[model samples]
Target chain A: MIWLERLLAISAKEARQLARDRVTFGMIIGVPVLQMLLFGYAINFDVRDVDAAMLDQSRTSLSRQLVGDLQATQVLRVVREAGSERELRELMQRGNARVGIVIAPDLERRLFEGNRPAVQLLVDGSQPALEKIAQGLGSMPLLKRAGTSATGVRRFEIRTEYNPARRTAVQIVPALIGTILTMTMVIFTSGASVRERERGNLELLITTPVTRGQLLAGKLLPYVIIGLIQTTLILGVGRVLFGVPMAGSFVDLYLGALVFIAASLSLGLFISTIALTQFQAFQMAFVTMLPSILLSGFMFPFEGMPAFAQAIAQVLPLTHCNEIIRGITLRGATLADMHVPLLKLVIFLVLMFSLAVTRFRKRLD
Target chain B: MTVAISARGLTRRFGAVTAVDGIDLDVPRAQIYGFLGPNGSGKSTTIRMLCGLLVPSGGTVNVLGHEVPREVETVRRKIGYMTQRFSLWDDLTVTENLDFMCRIYGLDGATRRARMKDRIRSYDLASHANQRAGTLSGGERQRLALAAATLQEPQLLLLDEPTSAVDPQNRRDCWENLFALVAAGTTILVSTHYMDEAERCHRLAILDHGRIAAEGEPKQLARDIDATVIEIECADLTAVRRVLVTVPAIRSVAQLGNRLHVLMHRDSADPERELRASLAGQCADARVERVGATLEDVFVAATQLRRPDVERAA
Candidate 1:
């Protein structure tokens, strides 16, 4: 019974202290919300709908069909139709299209004679991932058409400009920005609360009749809200300023951000509970954040990485967040489509949050 | 007759270091009990254990009749702890801090608000109710800490070095509030390093190296040592110790500023005769006078006996 009183005292004290401090409350709420707004809009992971211009030397039905197929894929939207290859190159240089497709003449003669036809694709390498995805999607229908012809007529050329090979930054920037916000919000709030404890203000709080559960919840709630705000901001900015598309539903993106926020906050709380000082908290948070970014597929493709990296990614909340965010934004996937990753995020939140609460309460005890 | 706080052989250890060794303590309702110890001598540890902030490694601690650790929550609610350092929310207004505390304690809306206001008024903080706690002076901050701790009207109040940094006037004022609480049937267990603060308690225990070296009414602990401390002023201190050390009754010799205090048992060392003889033989002019033993003397002797190595290490 006395133990209950003590818990109440501690909880009450924490609530009181937090309620009274406006800056801390702002830091808890405003920082995360601002970051969410910043990150949600500013960070985009999926490469979609690249603006394109085309040069068609053969104005035949075959050329039209090919152009139509390219447009049908939804990966490329033709911004301009060029009369000559020179004009197409000029358009590409003038930033008319990130990608340019050139179809050679005599394509109709080859089709009737049952001989091979030639085609060429040009892409700006400024963003390698988009260019790569564009090239892959650009070749799909032509390759399928050629496969149907048994007469050795399946030949095409794909030439990429700017970035000859897709670089990592095209895939990394959108997610890296979000992950950075997550790291900052979680570490800041967790360290702030723990610093108060180390300074012994926590004792003043415990003697006031607060429950550990209430205190922990109160401390975490503000950060969660803040994390959400950061997600919103990042997504908004990512879409508008950086041309990062939000192909997925806002709700789907939100759910993903929520899980990520909870996991990060809980991890932070866990660090705070175990640490003796703010420096220790910072060290632990950095340690957790570093591995999270490295193994979460933010810096590397999960598929390209070795099996060990894949397995490591499975255990990190960042891995699931990255997958959820990328899947939703890139594939326009619904929540149901992200069942496995969403489930993983849920389990991470529940387990990590429970453990953090247990450890934090135990410290008071 | 209510025993507001009780501990029997309460022991707490930090790994291999026993912060609070086996000890017994009891405080009747309305009594002020003080714990006196130097830094790291287990004063704060004992207070924490009593307030249910820390669980004892061995034995039982019953606060307000509730067993600790098991009923820590209950014990915690019943005790108000004002820690040695200022612990109020620096960014919050005084009223906000108090209200938040009340809310956490589950006090109802009207009651919580009214009690917070009353506390503010009582502590003479009404003018600063809207001022952030961080902006308050040290004395005001101390009052706020006290007010925040007492918000729940706890039956057992535990104050650990509550007045260490406060000015003399504020310290006296803080003590007055403590007395007021005691009169209202609150049992207070306070720990301090100040001799004057220790004297304010109804009963006190001097702890040294995690052990209770001496405990009782301050006057009684002083009387128990029963050493007639004589102040001797001499030009040559080495010659005085040579003559005084060999005396069978000279139990302790301590220096106080420029004067040397010779503590002698009543049976063997007569201060009047021995002082005159030593002065005539030493061939130096010196003045010696017997003085009643103060609590500081008793504390010094008890602490010395508990840790002889401290002196050797020094």
Candidate 2:
């Protein structure tokens, strides 16, 4: 009973202090909403309307039809017409166009002879995603459309699942839940211990009967509620604006989020014990945040990374959180299927909690 | 009398510097004990060690019959510490700070409510109960801090330079409150450099350079100082000071208004006569008379004028 009373006392104090801080209160809600909109609408992997230069070596109707067919795919637009291949190369070098299409002079003859390829598609290799899209044009059945008997040409069918429309917002919106939670929850308690020490409150606090566990738990309570609210805001905005389907149960998502939030706060508290000032705490938090954003499979493919980098990403909480959240939100996964990541999060929470408590000495040095 | 706090061979070092050297102390029950010293003289450090807020590098502390850094938890329940700085949450209101402290001390609902009301009224904080602690005046903040620290009514209270930021009137009022607390059978250990405040203590420890130079009642320490005091009234006090500095027996000389207060080695049989003999030819009009030693003289003898050679000879 006494422990509960002390815990409540510290929690109430922290809540009052946070309420009076206008900037922090505003940041709690403002950061999630702003980052959600910024990352959702601004990032697109399914590139379209790439500027292209065309070189027509032959004035036949067949060349015109070939150019029109490439445009019909909506992947490239003919912004410039080049008289020579060198001019098309210069156009790409000057950054005016990202793709180039050249129709050979003997296109009709080459189609009949079948000795060499009739059309050549040149793309700027600097943008790899655009290059992949431009290469897909090579597989189009141009001769078959021209009333020629098409011989043996290998064709493969590609189907994109979950996100059938290939909307970037769909992928980004669900994963934003994990990103936003990591950003806010890690920073919330990072400065807790340093701030108390800087304000001279630690001296008086340690003299009282409150234990370290009670103090840490009390400070973490309010921020957990704040994290849940931010989660709700992101989900609501994502559903209404982006039309991202809720394939999973809300209860399962929130449960996973609860474990992730606890783990992040424990890491923050551990950092708080290590930093001596608020500024240092913020810098250390940023150090963790940069890796969480870049290596958590948020913006990049996790498996495509080098072995060492993937190993680094495996240790980040957001890495597991991203998998769990994306699985539940887009793949409609149940908690039974998410036991591995959930167990990892629980282990991280315990490890960080013990580290923070052990590092936080009851007496000042 | 029961000892409220006792320490032996207490020492703390910060790398190359020793903040509190090997020291021994015992604070008795229900008395206002004071530590008088200048800045960097280990007053705050000593107070922190006594309250178990800081662990000593070497030595032992037994506070409230419980050994520190071992039984620190039990000792914490019986002690209240007010830091040199006002450490209450500045964003919280006066009432809120007291309420939080009350809850932390495990006071029941009825007792907490009653104590809050009582403290607000007694500390003259009823009018500004809702105002934030940061917005209060320095004096008001000190009062609020004191009120908050005493909410648990612990057996011992450790205050570190509590009145340094307060005005004279507020300082007096604070001392009155301290006396009241002492009368209620709560032992208080206060540290300050103010001589007037030190004089009010039942016992005083004069700290110097990480060591206790002298310890006793203020009046007793003054009477037992190792220097002879002689006041000389002269028209040209500066000239008198210049002449007195050349005398081998004189330890220190200070100008007080139009007179010169001279301290000579206690080995001099007649300090007043010796001072008059030394100034006879230079300025015969100087009036030399024996005077009683003050706390300032005691401080100078214990800290500034007591050289290594003099200490060895004594």
Candidate 3:
């Protein structure tokens, strides 16, 4: 009961202190909205309007038909025709085109001889995402369906489930809830704690009767509220403004997020215990944020990355939270379906809080 | 009177460096105790150990009859500590800072409110109650800090260089408040680098290189230093000092105002004659006279860098 009273006392004190810092409070509430808009509209991995050049050397009626086929997919728009192979290379080199369609010189004669002429799609190898998407367009359904129906055998039918439209915002906006919370939570909490240590408030607290557990818990409590508020703002904006669906129960999202936010708060506290100055704390927090954004499947699919990167992603709190958010919002995942990630977050919180308290000495040493 | 804090063979180390080594201390109740040392001499380290903010690398510490770092919780409940740097919540108002500390110390509602009102008046913080602590002037901030530290009526107060930032007027007022606390039967242990402040303590300890060089009343420390004080007047006191320090019998040389106050080995029976002869032999003209020792001389003599042979042995 005494520890609880002291916890409440320190929490109220921190809340009052943060309330007086108008700029910080404004940023805490404003950044998520700004970030949601920025990431939701701008981060589209579904590549479109790809610039394409046609090098139809044959110039025959059949080759003309193929050019129309590429354009019908709406992904690649043929913008130029190369006079020769050298000119086609020039189009790619001048940055005028990202994809090039090349047809053989004598396709009809080669077809009559029963030895098929070589046709190729040359693409810019730079920008791996653009390269992969452009290559996929070359093999789009327009080309495949026009070439063959192979009516002799039967192939199994495929069906897409949950996010059948493959909307990046549907996935990214929900994941942004985790990212915005991660950045703001680490920035607000660790920055505040390290500033106190630098300014001597932490030292003063150490001399008080408050235990380490109470002090850390109290210091992080205010930031947890800030994290929750930020999470809710991002989520609400994501659902209403961006049309990201909330397929699962709100209770599932809230309960999952509580554990996820605790993990982030504890991570920040661990960073504060190690950082001697506010600058160091800020640097450390951002360094942690980078991995969360890159490896959390927020920007890229987790399965698409290399196995080693997947291993690193497994340890990050943001990775699991990203999965939890996307699963609940996009897949209509229930609380039962999210136990693995929630359990991971809980385990991470326990370890991080323990390490933080153990590393945080009462002495200046 | 029962001692408020007592330590025996207390030691603290960082890697290979020993900060507080084999030091013993006894601070009595209802008295002002001063800790004096030069930079890196471990004054702050000792105060931290006594407050149970730091663990002794060896030996033991007992504050208010509780073993330190083990019964540190009990000690923390009874003692209030003010650090060398400003430690109050900078973004909070003056009243909010005091309220926070009172709650942290588990003060109940009525007592908290009454003491908060009393300190706000006595500490000259009534007009600045709603001002953010970061915007306050240096002196006003220290006043707020002291008011917050003492808001709970702690039994023993530990202050580490509490006046290092304030102007002279505020420093005087701050010491007046400290004396008032002592009058109310609160034990105070304060560390300071100022000689004037050191002279104000009832009992004091001079630390040098993590060891207690001397401990007693300031005047007693002055009287007990084993050195002959000789003041020299000359056109070039620097030149005279250079010649006098070359003599093995002369232990140290320090310039006070226009003259040099030289300390010689106590065994040197003819200190004045020895100093003048040494200066004259080097063809430096000077006048020498024996002078009574002061607390400044005691500090210099107690912390004098010992010869290499003696230092290594210790």
Q: Which candidate number would show the highest DockQ if scored against the true structure?
A: 2
| Residue range A89-198, candidate 2, lDDT tens digits | 99999989998888889888888777788888888888757766766667766567776655225467777888899888888998898899888888779886689889
Give the candidates in order of lDDT, highest first: 2, 3, 1
Candidate 3 residues lying further than 4 Å off, grouped into runs, are: A57-66, A104-120, A130-159, B228-292, B305-314
User: lDDT (0-100) at residue B186 of candidate 1?
Assistant: 88
Q: Positional deviation of B214 in candidate 1, in angstroms?
A: 2.0
User: Could you give me the TM-score of model 3 versus the true structure?
Assistant: 0.88
Model 3 residue A270 distance off true place after TM-score fit, in angstroms = 1.4
Candidate 2 interface RMSD to the true structure:
0.8
Model 1 vs. true fold: TM: 0.76
Worst 10 residues of 2 chain A by lDDT: A146-155
List candidate 1 segments past 4 Å from native. Answer: A1-181, A244-248, A362-365, B233-242, B245-248, B254-260, B269-271, B283-287, B305-314
Least lDDT summed over 10 consecutive residues: which range in candidate 1 chain B? B304-313
- How many clashes (backbone N, Cα, C below 3 Å) per candidate? 60, 0, 0
Give the winner by DockQ: 2 or 3. 2
lDDT of 1: 0.75
Ranking by TM-score: 2, 3, 1
